[model samples]
Target: MIKNVEIRQALPADAPAIEALYPAAFPDEDLVPLVRDLQELAAISFVGLANNGLVAHAAFTPCSLAGRGDNVALLGPVAVAPDRQRQGIGSALLRAGLRHLQNAGTGWVFVLGDPGYYGCLGFKPDDDVRPPYRLPEEWRGAWQSLSLSEHKTPLRDQLTVPQAWRRQALWTPYGL
Candidate 1:
């Protein structure tokens, strides 16, 4: 279990470490490029700094909502060091990142993640906002959203992720 996890904005110098993190965190998945490209594209990102190093990371990319005035972002590709998994470092880091986004006037944040895990972070199934590509029916519940604003407005629209996230494999509901 990690203590003294300081949450901070991910710096460019942290790229190397962040690149190494995903492969270790998800050995069977090639999530490094997703986050690396996102960072290069200036995605809103954060890191959990600990005595050892950056033990956790989370990145959110801006998304355009069709006909919606609200500012929205898509959260993904969060990673926690293998040893730090389930120690709450990832969750705390995510909470800190979410707070930063909320304070920055982000109206809502969407994530394609496990309902149980993200639900703890205030995300709910938002059938109104559809993903860029249609997700499998079995994975529909995996698409969720969390409102950062006080106003309970339904973010009803189609989500268009930034070019950095246009990879079809990233949107696939299977083999991952």
Candidate 2:
């Protein structure tokens, strides 16, 4: 982990820095545009800053189940500066983002990512709420959820993500 790393909400002024981060953080993937779209759409994002500059970013946005009233959100496109990967910065920033969501009373959050990584963060395989698109069988376990509510039960309905996350491409694990 980087010492003295500060975690805070990403601001409009940090847009350029965040834009610069994804390319370096995810060299094999083109995530700059995704992050840009999410930010422009007002996703709740958090940034980790060190003495060097912006080193990490994670975003969250509202999602809901059809015909149900629930406070749900989606976590995605998390990036850590390539040099900072696996050093705990990603997890720290994500935890910070989750804390913000919990404080805002978000009932549930879902993500499609490495089960091992997200599992360590308290996410569990989510069987109740289905993704906007069916995941490949291999990735079924990667589609996970974390309950922020005391009830800890899914709405038992389909998930609806934000506009920036509606793409079928994002729902699949192919590009990663």
RMSD of each: 2.0, 1.7
Off by over 4 Å in 2: 174-176
Model 1 Cα shift for residue 128 (angstroms): 0.2
Give the TM-score (vs. native) of candidate 1: 0.93
- Candidate 1 local lDDT, residue 121: 93
Summarize candidate 1's per-residue lDDT along 41-84 as a digit string, tens digits.
89999998888598889998888797455589999889899898
What RMSD does model 2 have?
1.7
Error of 1 at 84 (Å): 0.7
Q: List the residue pairs that clash in candidate 1.
A: none
Off by over 4 Å in 1: 67-69, 173-176
Clashes of each: 0, 0
